[model samples]
Target: MKHPTSYRTSIIGRTAGRLGVLTAACLTALAVAAPAEASTFSYPGHGVAVVHDRATTHADRAHPDQYRDSFAIHELGAVFGLGADNRATAVSAGCSASHPCRSIALSFQIVTMAGSHVRINATNLGRAVNEQCPGCQTLAGAYQFIVSTPAPFSLDAQARNQLAVIHHRLDALQTSNASIDDIKQRADALAAQVKTILDRAAAAAPKDREVNPLGTTGPSVTMHRHFDGPS
Candidate 1:
């Protein structure tokens, strides 16, 4: 009779060194997946030239004006009677160190104006702008507000929510052991849902009416998106 070969019942070929490396890798992956950073987004372009497409949460005064429109918040310009006008509405008294200033993205109807301050319907709150001209008023007033264009719900928020759902479904499909047909079916459904979401978001996106190109007329909002899954 041949002698039985010896073999350990434990994990085969997984030495202490290998185990340590595996554990370290798993920990690193977990660390990297702490949380998803909010994706930065901006609304449809003005149909002519480039559009303002960024927002800031942190306060910084890199420029001399300190608290000026900077067109950083061009939407705010529309609120101040800039309103799809081909020419920029100039502000005589820009936010300087002496004047003190701040700008914020708004998602509400501008009901009225109190000097440089504007009253919005959303949350019954008002914010101040850097307009020194007392007699100037918005030609488009409520319609000038971006939020008013897509009143009630923000298209950005809706798009983000749909994206989150799509991501979750994709993650599930990745880890699944379903058959080929099942996979294809699920994928098709997801694709349809994605198309619907995009249609809605595009419909909801804001437009500048006629902000650029002086007098040339063009299409309204043009909502566009791209996906670069997993950082």
Candidate 2:
């Protein structure tokens, strides 16, 4: 793998020239298997592989001057997936209605998606995170990073089959002609087994999250990550 690139915060959403991370065949397989997830995080770059895009409005009672006004607009990416890229990126937007947005400092992490069950390259996901969004940026101290929210991407074929098998077992248990107590016993056993399986899957599954514990302290703020499409 190449040495990780340095990322700086920019109010204007832009991308430097990118190097290809995978061959055509590998990239094709990844495109088909990994679908866009719906969740996101802020202050990324820890263990997670993807950061879904999100936005939030924060008010700073102490330093309103740092922001255009008191409140600032923060745009963060969704958490990372296992088979995705290691370095995640997000932007920070200022509060001013008239001012343009900008990216944040320490905006990315350096990771290599190796040592996992799946091996999906992260080129496409990385590009999407850095280049796709427009007017993406926020003011200083608008976003917070407390912990990583694990957002798993679509399971590969084998993982899906494993899940399907568990579902089938649950269905069979529901239809079995047994006393409630007996069914409960059997179901309990099944649940234990399922937990074991899920644990393994979770270990192998492509997971993502952000890393920002002890974020800027203020009243708890609600952040919204928007990737739904044009208004």
Candidate 3:
């Protein structure tokens, strides 16, 4: 007759096999649920580029000088505009008093990845005031960034962080009715989170281990990134 212990071992092995199969099925489900997201904008090869014109307009009108400030916030980082123009031109100071304003055409490329998160390395192609010459009207202001997400539950964490920041900004703006402040706060927070995720992912990777088992080994996730253009 077979020993009881031997029979128990056989049973245990069968159970382990079933558990592995279940785990694989769950992972497959997660991968199926995860979705890819992206956004893009195109600007005319020529003309001025405007960054945060809406917010800047308010700031310029509110402040003594026609000075306005804006920022491009992404999950990876944020870029604040020191100055800008409607047409693609070299970053220049305020238009001369004689030529207070200039009309310039522009195009834009904006991509948002995942529902609440923005990716870096997303390219922005447009023309604005040339930063080199604060007063010159030449093709200027072309910004590019490399936005990266993290591994090991990185996507989920980033999404949560972004949602939290969005809610906080919405609340603050609604309470004070400060549109610019609200936008800025939300943008900054999102950029910080994206950067954090990317940084963490980079750090987690081993120098010699090119393969990130944590990101690819497990079940996948569903993600969405949203983008809205100028109305």
Candidate 4:
């Protein structure tokens, strides 16, 4: 019994009314779940070590020094993980009494422990049988290290909202003529609330990284935030 055009208009109005309700719901949800400002973490620098080998003479081979050169990566508190890369280059050639001076073949091992120090060991072939040429058969190598860091600190909508409420309360207190003691007590309570909020955020943040080479836990990265109550 309805006109075709009027029926279409009625249907259109109902559809638009439903769409408007859905849009309002979405906007309210977005506002309530608004995200906090963006944040990022700080990354530590990489570790490195370089070595220059000393020439081993045939006679000196009789009493070879067992100890190798090593270096440590300090300030590891922020480092979470590490990767090591090493390479060696032949520096010189040495001649023995029986053979002509030739480049000596060298092999090395880069050892990293759970801690920061890295040990570099160059293989000692054998005692030289004849008088050896000086400064021959030496190599130079370097160890480059890569480090991983933690994620940055950030707050979610809930934390931001909690902070905002605390801010408003503090602002009201600041403008009030309440007793100094009462103000101090309220301020202290607010500061405690702030600490609790920050502590929860930190607990949920990224933890320390485990470095493969270190074979143990790396240094801990922590954010130190202070909340001072009203004096």
lDDT scores of the candidates, listed in order: 0.26, 0.28, 0.25, 0.29
How would you encode candidate 1's per-residue C-alpha lDDT over 1-231 as one tens digit per residue?
Answer: 212211111110100001011133433333333332111111122111111221111112232111111111122222211111111111223334553322221111111111111122121121223354232211100011122222112336656577456646643543444543454455446545655654555455444334432423322331122111111
Q: Rank candidates by TM-score, best first.
A: 4, 1, 2, 3
Q: How well is each residue in 64-175 modelled by candidate 4, as lDDT tens digits?
A: 2111211112212222222222222222223444433222111111111222332222222212222344533232222222222233233457866775676556445424
Q: After superposition, how far is residue 56 of candidate 3 from its true place, in Å?
A: 15
Model 2 segments beyond 4 Å from truth? 1-151, 206-231
- TM-score-best of 1 and 2: 1
Worst 10 residues of 3 by lDDT: 7-16
How does residue 75 of candidate 3 score in lDDT?
27
Q: Tens-digit lDDT track for model 3 on 112-170?
A: 12211211121233333322223322222222223222221222455446534543443
State the TM-score for model 2: 0.26
Candidate 3 residue 78 Cα shift, in angstroms, is: 25
In model 1, the Cα lDDT at residue 32 comes to: 36
Candidate 2 per-residue lDDT over residues 13-54, each given as its tens digit = 111111123344644454344433222222233222332222
| Model 1, residue 36: C-alpha shift (Å) | 22
